[model samples]
Target: MGLWATPTLAVLPSEQLKDPALEARARAVSAGLRCVVCQNQSIDDSDAPLAHDLRVLVRERIVAGDTDAQATQYLVDRYGHYVLLKPPFETATWLLWLGPALVLAGGAGGIVLWLRRRPTAVPALAADEEAEVARLLGDNR
Candidate 1:
């Protein structure tokens, strides 16, 4: 309703781990995971059923003695890097990390090439045109 309103979290009381530490870790992991259905919202924020499943999965992994990274990795293995809000920079993901910079460089190169090819000199006015201008000034006086 208001600007900057906090999102209603999709994390239900039933899904939370009994241990506060594990619940905190699960929430942290969920915050970094993208909801496959929602795409843009994190699993922690998305209300979709798939997001809820992923949230539960994260808690399950944490309670099963997996570290935060391992829990995140489990999802990543099953869902691929798309599940991570920030994917790792790897051979398979090099383009994702560098594509913007490549585009910017290409645009900059195009501008430089266009500048070099642009005509710089202004053509001089003809003698008759200059005389007509002088006559017009005389008439105005």
Candidate 2:
């Protein structure tokens, strides 16, 4: 762990809010936001313009007297649930959360089908049908 040891928030000098408490709360909120630019990195750890904008937006919401939850919800309302690092389990995200499980179950069923042996010899032709064939062929040519 070196320069990357600490999460690199793109908080510019001019953008650092004066109130430490408010800034701390903003950072906490940012930690749960997914950076649209980085995709995988949290906004708290991204320097992308969108990440910076989101951070500022969170702070602005806090200063406007919105509670933390409200501020977060505001972002969600704007960006869709994809902006949240941990999206809630709901109809919209059921496929995202359960897609892999469904695929695995389907593959297992396929494998079981492939591994099973086929029916050996077409129902054995029935006992009477076998006797008829024998008589048609004669006792022994």
Candidate 3:
């Protein structure tokens, strides 16, 4: 593929609904759903068999007269919140959303504490050590 070439989508012509409006809705919903097999990709962008199945399922739900919310909820009901690309901020998902910030804050606090406790100055040499250094240098009065 050329450097600027866009990757082809997995949505085959046969999989698209006859109704354009419904197809658009299906695409929108597919964009929000994650591919179980390709965990990092949305169903719309993934070519995995599971992603194809999910794409078909979303289209089917849209054609069945389900509202966008209802269709999305149906998938959530079957697959749990993991299927959502952006999961809701609830008790179960709080850590997923907040864990990075919490870790960063902990790291920053540890660095601050270390800096505060570290030694800042060198101690002065004792009188005997200074006298020895002068004798070694052959200093005389």
Model 1: per-residue lDDT, tens digit, 1-141? Answer: 632375565788789788888888999999999999989999999889989988998888888899999999999999999899998999999998999999999999999999989987878879998898888898775
**Tens digit of lDDT per residue, candidate 3, span 1-141?**
543475586777789899888898999999999998889999999989888988999888888899989999989998999999999999998998999999999999999999989988878889998888888888562
**Shift of residue 69 alpha carbon in model 2, Å:** 1.0
lDDT of each: 0.90, 0.86, 0.89
Which regions in candidate 3 have their CA more than 4 angstroms from the true location? 1-7, 95-141
Give the clashing pairs for model 2. Answer: none
Q: Report residue 73 deviation for candidate 1 (angstroms).
A: 1.3
For residue 49, what is the lDDT in candidate 2?
88
Candidate 2 overall lDDT versus native: 0.86
Candidate 1 deviant stretches above 4 angstroms: 1-7, 98-141
Q: Looking at candidate 2, what is the lDDT of residue 41?
A: 88
Model 3 TM-score, 2 decimals: 0.63
lDDT of 1 at 97: 94
| Native-to-model Cα distance after best TM-score fit, residue 90 in candidate 1, in Å | 1.1
